[model samples]
Target: MKIEVNITKEPTKEPISFEIVDMSKKKYSEVKIYIPKKKGRKSVAPGDKWYVYFYWRDPETGKMNIKCKYYRGINQKKTVAEREEVAKAYQRSYQMLLEQGWNPLKNKIKNQRSSPKKQKHTLKSAIEYALAIKIRNTKESTARDYKFRSQFFLDWADVNFKSGLPLEQFKLEDFYQFMDYLELDYINKASGERLSNTSIDNTRRVISALFTELKNKRLIDTNFVKGIPKLKSEPLKNRPFTHSQLIEIKKYLEEHDPYLIQFISFLLYPILRPIEITRLKVRDLNTEDWILGVETKTEAFSYRKIITKMQPIIGQMELKGYPGSYSLFTNENKPSIWLPKQEKSKVNHFTNRFKKVKKALGYGKEYGLYSFRHTAIGDLYNSKQAEGIPEQQIIYDLMPITRHKSEAGLRNYLRNIKIALPADHSDIYTIDF
Candidate 1:
């Protein structure tokens, strides 16, 4: 293992390069000098640190791992020639150590070898194992979501590959094939419809998570899922319900499923997400201060004022009568006992109910439970604009109501939802043509 180091001055501005020559007649992988980049400068500055970087191939795994020998003392030299001499000296010392079988990762490699062998995994087993770990760490709703997305890849693998395919055998190319399957052939067993690009991308994320877990557990060498590029997904914006549609829905819910009206009120007035509303308990409401403690997506909880619209709705409900621990919105659409298992179904209960109402009204997929929130926010913005309220004041007022952190965020949300359109623009722009 007698290795030689040779320095070469390329006609470049920043670097004095070097290479490792193996006297045993073998070439070392990726041997070079690494110079730190300087802003607004093409050449290496007077005090910039650099290093000799190379790769060391592992005997067991045959993996080329990175190794570096830094040359900070080179910077202490005042002149270019002096610095080059010091760098060469350091490089030679490093080359000698390499010839003597010195390895930066020697201790790491020994520890890895001494450690217990990782359990082997098949494609099916690896996915299941990863899912188990994921399910254990995440919340029930999140765990369910992970599992739901994972099933798509699991089903695809079962059909396409041998049942006993080893985890290592599933390469980057195979993952791309699975992605193609998702894009072209896969259909939802429940909906009997092809998944949108966004849905497919979501599935990609879940699969990526699983592969990452497997890699961490040492079930496989590489996470092929990470190599797959993310597909660009067109954002799916839910349209706000028109005034006539809102009136129709309100009238219909009042007669058919009045309980749902209470649930929708939470979405409409407080502008709560369906999931957030489901997580709310009776104790969260403060009638004295007219403040509603909301379960937010990011934080443990947040507060929103009980607006004039929601005041009557809360008064109608016998929330105080129930135990404070009881969920605010139950299957019965009132504050009542909610079992642990029932927590998962709370959002779906309202969503399905809303779907039924939409179906009866001859509504399409564009209208959803979220549409109520968008509709309410959009209408509020339009109403305030009509009243000649300053736009900044209107946005500031809506901030606490919508729970947006910044004016820019709220503005972007309004823009993304296509709200606050100027009324009768055609009439204003009309000319005698």
Candidate 2:
């Protein structure tokens, strides 16, 4: 049987008040015991379900929103009459609450505030939550890296700590122990090689970034990852290709794999990293305006001019009727739909494809796909120097093309690549003699 809960007020100028009445016909005054209809061998029971239903005005939308409160615990009563008594008690409580300005929405906030334990997050959940936020703010490749790194850490934690460790309870000492594990004990399952200092540091950086986000969200008291120092990484192994090596590689790519050469052009001309090139959409290119839109890791979008050298290559693409959503580079090295899951694989595909070219040319690990961009930047820097441009002016001019935000960053990159070297040191030796 259905129960009615009517809350009415006095007939005076003030709202008439009545705690309880029979008004089940009115939509807002219905409390009911729900029973599922028997189907096949299943039996229906009185205590199967119970609900208190009413209407409350939504503060934000100014619309009447239906609110429901379910009390399955009422079924704990032994008999039908006892369950009905408990249900009636619950209805009176709900009626009392509604009369005192208790909103289902607002009461939720009140309960959360009154009970801080509801906000507690376990170590695994905290990272998962942080990752959910991080993925939205970063590129797909970067998000993949974050997810892989975060999962690796979680797997490590599963082995070391008891399951479901609360985030706040994870101490700085625990983080240091994890770092030690990465440096000393961690092994690559695919290759069976121990993690290098650089690899360990990379893990640390990703975890630190995730923890930083967790702290900003107040999920944790502190980012213990920051307390641990970075391990000493190995020396830079990837160097820019020499001028002669560049010509050789280009010639090899053009002769053997012409499609791959176009990928190189985008990297060199736009100074895009391999992963960034994977992010390009067909619509990002504007042939008439001679501009290419690049979604960089740091910025949402940036424009790069399509220079005269790049114009011919863009024309060769023949990008006329292809959908704007199509990827500029794909498996066949042409424009097509690039699925989000396929973005990282496409990068690895191009990289592995380039490795074949590298093998054909007898190139070492130091020289790979990124060498094209590095070589182009070095050539540009040297070309400006040959024009007798000032070092400061050259840095200022290179900033936009290189997509470096500051002159110092560009200078640091040039210095690291050893492009800004002393010219004709023999003059100094002769003068000293």
Candidate 3:
């Protein structure tokens, strides 16, 4: 926390026999000094020579911060006394900046606004920037989650402004109010229900992330969503599809929509999530052993081994000309494979088709596309058990193939199945021979 202060003579045109040189390198927590810049020497007043500079690391960015104040010194031709007064006025300006959280000793503006402010950020632009970085770094599934949450925030924030709200002037309470609006005013477009605390909290997180990045880039004055607690939320209860229901749905799809049958077949056997299934390309499937390298949520090759059951579906799909450059499951008319990072259209088409099929089957919203994966998990669990696989063994074998993060996710998937272990009661009853 030690900051050494010293004043060095400015480089002047008048040559001096001896120059005062301080050759010392030291780290500082804070430093207050004059800004050095070459001035035009056309008989300018000393008052105009008064220049103040502040340098520090930004609180949000932790990067070296720099700001300069060009105060109008007493008009050009000023006496020594006037120059002294101007110097004192600039000194006062520097002190005021220090008072407002500029820690020269630490070389960082403590509260983050002491530095020169950047251009005001529009809500849409800020969100798009963050989303671009998120999409670039993460899997499409995670990007979709961020995008999903960000939309609600933009919708809630931009209700009053058509262009976009400026993030610079936002207060901490504005975020709180945003959460309140999410709870009361915002409606879930999918379900037509008031936004839940969980959903609102998720939106809050996305905004916090946006602010964090914006502040890092010095785009915003402060981190608006920082330190806000997440609202408590109730966990969702999922209903796994039953075997009879699956059979009925399958028969319906087989008869009416061969495309959907192939699509669902890919989802059910390997128990791939909708996003992973959407990433499946025809060339990704190995014709020899059918080791379909799946692009899962966490790791691309987590589900490297395609199940023996899925091979038949792949064959059926192949027979229909699932070319190397096309997606494994496509619309009735197979579109070309979504190249590297573009999956928006693929997801949209897949979701719309799933919705239609689910509606046609008269299934509730709860039993949507993801339920196929859920049902697949249940089927795998039961079939493995029936074949005398140990409980832990079944979970182990399925974890890599299903790409579940842990045994806990697998257990959670089975929570809806109402499974009960069969125990031998003969020991307690003392069976007679």
Q: Judging by TM-score against the true structure, name the best candidate.
A: 2
lDDT of 2: 0.73
lDDT of 3: 0.61
Which of 2 and 3 is ahead in lDDT?
2
Per-candidate TM vs. native? Answer: 0.62, 0.70, 0.58
Instruction: Please give the distance, in angstroms, between residue 29's alpha carbon in candidate 2 and its true position after superposition.
Output: 25
| Model 1 lDDT, full chain set | 0.73
Candidate 2, pairs of clashing residues = 8-18, 9-16, 9-17, 10-16, 10-17
- Can you write out model 3's per-residue Cα lDDT over 1-433, one digit (the tens) per residue? 4344555555697554543333242212232434323463322334335444555445455555545444333333133333333444445444544544445555543333334353344666666555544444454445557767777667766775632666555677667777777777767589889877766777778778877876776777678587887777653533567878888888887777768777777777766777677777767777687677777666646436666767776666544464676766655445364443345566677778767777888876666677777667777777788777788898898877666789998777566444423334466886687
**Segments of candidate 2 deviating more than 4 angstroms:** 1-118, 235-237, 321-323, 425-433
Q: Give per-residue CA lDDT, model 2, range 1-433, as digits (tens).
A: 3555566756678876554433333334444444334564212265355444566655455455666665635555433334444455455555544554455764663463354344656787677656655654345456568778888989988998733798888878888888888878878799998987878888888989889888777666678787777776543555788878878987987789989878989888888988889889999998889998997778878888999999998888889999999989988667998664335677898999999998999988877777788878988988888787888888888888888888878887887777565444464564552
Angstrom error at residue 213, model 1 = 3.9
- Against the reference, the lDDT scores of all candidates come to 0.73, 0.73, 0.61
